[model samples]
Target: MLPYHDAALPVADRVTDLLGRMTPAEKAGLLCHAPVAVAPDGGLVDEPRTLLPTAPTTHAVRDLHLRCLTLMAPVAAGPLARWHNEVQALAARSMLGIPVLVSSDPRHSANENPLTSVPSGGCSRWPEPLGFGALGDADLVRDFARVIRAEYTAVGIRMALHPMADLASEPRWCRTAGTFGADPDVVGALAGAYVAGLQGDDLGPDAVASMVKHWPGAGPQAGGEDAHFASGKDQVYPAGRFDLHLSRFRPSLHAGVAAVMPYYGRPVGVDGLAGVGFAFDPKVVAGLLRRDEGYDGLVCTDFGVLTDATLADGTVWPARAWGVEHLDRVDRAALLLDAGVDQFGGEWCPEVVTDLVAAGRVAQGRVDESVRRVLTLLFRLGLFENPYVDEGNAVATVGRADFVAAGEAAQRRSMVLLANDGVLPLAEGIRLYVEGVDRATAERYTTVVDHPEDADVALVRLDAPYEPRQRLPEAFFHQGRLDLPDDRREHLCALAATVPTVVDLFLDRPAVIPELAGHAAALLADFGAADEAVLDVVFGRARPEGRLPFELPRSMAAVEAHPEDLPGGTRDPVFPLGHSVEALDWRPRTSEPQKG
Candidate 1:
């Protein structure tokens, strides 16, 4: 039989055939993802460049049909169109003529930064996903996804690495606001809707693909934390306990997500396994995802998270524990390939694999398998048929009025009214005292006041500080639980006494509201959002329809209760799961007027 890479057949057919023809070294090259840049001198620059890089030359590596290109966000339609044109041209140069896939992280939101691209040119800044979850409207979620899809597709971003399916069980999880909710059904349903909207009826080149992520549930870190640090990196899905978290992901997979990006956290019992990261784990990626669940989609790793950088002494360490330790780049490649990963997202390490082949450490056959999978996905995405778009369309398509409306709508829905003393639905034209409100958001309500003493009603928005207490490191904050020193609590108590405050906590995890509960006239909680929409809920312009998605622990000790001991398990939280109070009609005190 002819090998998979042989040129005499259709591109897809050739990819399959060529897989058999190539050595493992060649196959591994396809799994490596890198930013595509034009070499200043028209040469292939393997390393990323600081300059405005153009697409790679089509003729330079015609034989090596690259699978995907990772692009930064806020990219305009013109540049995107040029990228598509270049990729298509490259595909045409090859005998198989396979197109290249383009991907990016959430770029449609205000939080776009190094991890994501944001064009100085206008793009609608939607409130984060947490606000959408608070709204409890699946349709709104779909609308949000649709707008994002239109914006991404207009700019040639074919895949959206979003709708983070992880449960918001841990409030301190940095990415909590990106998820739908803590309930399996809620997260699952919303995630499915998001995927459907993104892919739509037409899974064509113009439609964006969804990469729902942090598989097998990333909410439960060792201490209710992020999985990046070695101390907090292990994932514990105790036997029979996997279902609690896995429920959200199963629905997303069923919803036909185009890709799954396993987190960098090491799964329990993954030690000594050939592949360190769950991204390269057979049990998680191959056995569970492919076999048991029956998902045959592409699997990509989180960016800059797989392998450690070279040290001053030239030693390469694992970037995360889930990443293989003590392995050279080639060995890591071999492990990932054997474990069934389709591609490496974020960073080009193809040279590492190529070097391994040259040193005879890796078999050529293994590389071919990965390459075939990568090519298959790109070809399926229809990148070859439609590669480029007009630059003008990029800015024009982003942040459209409809998109902004959807974003605002999502923000309104996500606000949850935790408690109301019937002082809400403020009468129009009342002076409102606001703290921590964005200047623009406050302009709509009342004159910004330096002190709450002169204001009619005091409103405050406080986030769990990202900065750590003097004694505690910042990592403690990332973990949902914080054991504040008594002195710190005392200091907070002093601050609370100054105002009859309406406190709003962005609950990433359930914290003790009672600590400062006495000082506030009313307390409100939300997963995440800007202050304007939050104020809308405060004044009852929009009803607080949100219910508590997870249990709130009254105390850290209550949180420590066994998961079985609690409603779900011994893990009893201070606030039981599903605790929510409705906003009541409040007539302002006779002396104090209601605020708008």
Candidate 2:
């Protein structure tokens, strides 16, 4: 006997009534998630046998009501329609008829990838958030959000875990591409517009719920790196820098974001809270977010991260920090619940939660609290109103021509001019040499050259190292002890020696900018969409108006002086923050060909 029936009632009260009737096993079921098809059969993680156990095997609607299910993998365009239909059918078979809440990581772009998760069926692959900030156009930000919302809603995805509001304070952070910029005001305004575009005029039915993430902030990690592993878990905020980071979140919260996600890093010294990550700390989650901030929305933990874990990639690791490995999964769940985490993102430990209740290690009341919050979020998202999709519109709505147009516009706006030595806006018909341009993107520009010597104006593109999968070819992820590897450095140096190179480094994180002080003609760096828009700026089709969003450290040593000690940590960037050189007028020194 669940509590309330009318969907129109307040979400908290409705959830409260429903939580009172659930059995311990049913409450535990809400905490577990099964992985579905990550991609069509033949791609990475291709074993169907590996995936079968994760598929939704049975619906426990009647006996013990199941609340929600997060999809494991992304479904293909052709099969997505069928998949949604099947998922809806599963819900119908359940006792409570609760529709599954399908969600996903950022799928609107190709940059962040293992490509193991589901691909968005319909949506233009917009430039990453850093690119959006470069545009500095609020309307485009709104449009990008709307396009993502349309694609997600069309495909039966009710919630979007996106519009990462973290600022790019630490350039070495691997996830810098996902954030807006270094300034909190800029990130806040753009992020809010993105939220508005996703949710629409009405907060309830018209818009998809936006989950603003890594609450408080995850930007200031010890080293500009992810906090997931032990090496980069400490977060230090001196003299209340938290207010600067909180600037972005405040707007999203006011705009009625549906949920918040805390990061994995532990914080040091704030209001008697000694050292604790927000995910496992009641002071951070309940005290700050829920109590002080007045955010009534659901709070979920980051995926596959727990305070303690007995398993490591399916193998056991020795007992680690915080007594995590020693504590069982149930105890971990209890800690999360008490700390005010409403839902476990991509966690697969339902049996442990069940065991805890049976053993009386965890109270039934606490389980009910988390379950209520999860259900409340689902209901607020309007999942129950109509959970099935039309299927026919899935492909048509996603990444359509209009959406691509919007993405292109955003890409153009984000281009910032780093340097121009009167050689830019090359005279019409001058041969242009470009390295690192993809075939499709190159076609938009002049012909790409095999060697820089053959062309009149040489352009090259570079990016910070990002290994898409957890297991990358050893050559890419690192070299010796520092971030950039030897082979990549050698390759770039070879190209710089060949011509008066115009280098465009995709400045997501500050990498070791090779000593091209005398080697290259001009250097231009940008945070987003470096490949696509660099061509436009090169030929004077578009003006380079962007400025460095954050400080570019000279070397890894300089980065170490800051809170998040990054590789290439030196304070002297080849070009400092806000450094941009305008295109200069040029005259050929001599028309005569010189000996190569």
Top lDDT prediction, candidate number:
2
Tens digits of per-residue lDDT, candidate 1, 1-596, equal 35433433566785666555555444555675555543322233344353322234342235444556665434445555555556656665655454566676676554423333333234566655655655556887787777877777776678877768887655445556567656666778888888988988756666788888888677765545566556666665433355566667876787778888878777665334343567767777777777878887777777655455443244343366355656655666666656667677654556666776677766666556556666666655566455665657765777677776666666556556665564465544545566567767876864555665555656777664343423212222334453345675675565556545577777654565556565566777765556766777766666566676655555666544433101233244444555567655533222344333
- Candidate 2 displacement at residue 116 in angstroms: 11
Total clashing pairs for each candidate:
51, 23
- Give candidate 1 regions above 4 Å deviation: 1-14, 17-27, 35-67, 72-98, 110-122, 238-240, 269-276, 310-318, 321-323, 355-365, 466-499, 560-574, 583-596
lDDT per residue as tens, model 2, 1-596: 34456766777777776667656676776765434443443122223333223333343323334444455555654456556666667666765666777666677654534212234444566666777666577887887887888777777766777778887776666667677867566788988898888888776654687788888788876655456555556776653576677666888888888778888777765565637666777877888888988987778777655423333135332211232435655666777778778777655456667777788877777777677767776677776676778767877776678887776666655666665556565554555677677756765655555666787767777776544434321122221122356787666677767666787777665555646434667776655553666677666666666655565555666565665422122455666655566544322232323323
Best by TM-score: 2
Worst 10 residues of 1 by lDDT: 561-570
Task: Estimate TM-scores for all models.
Answer: 0.81, 0.84
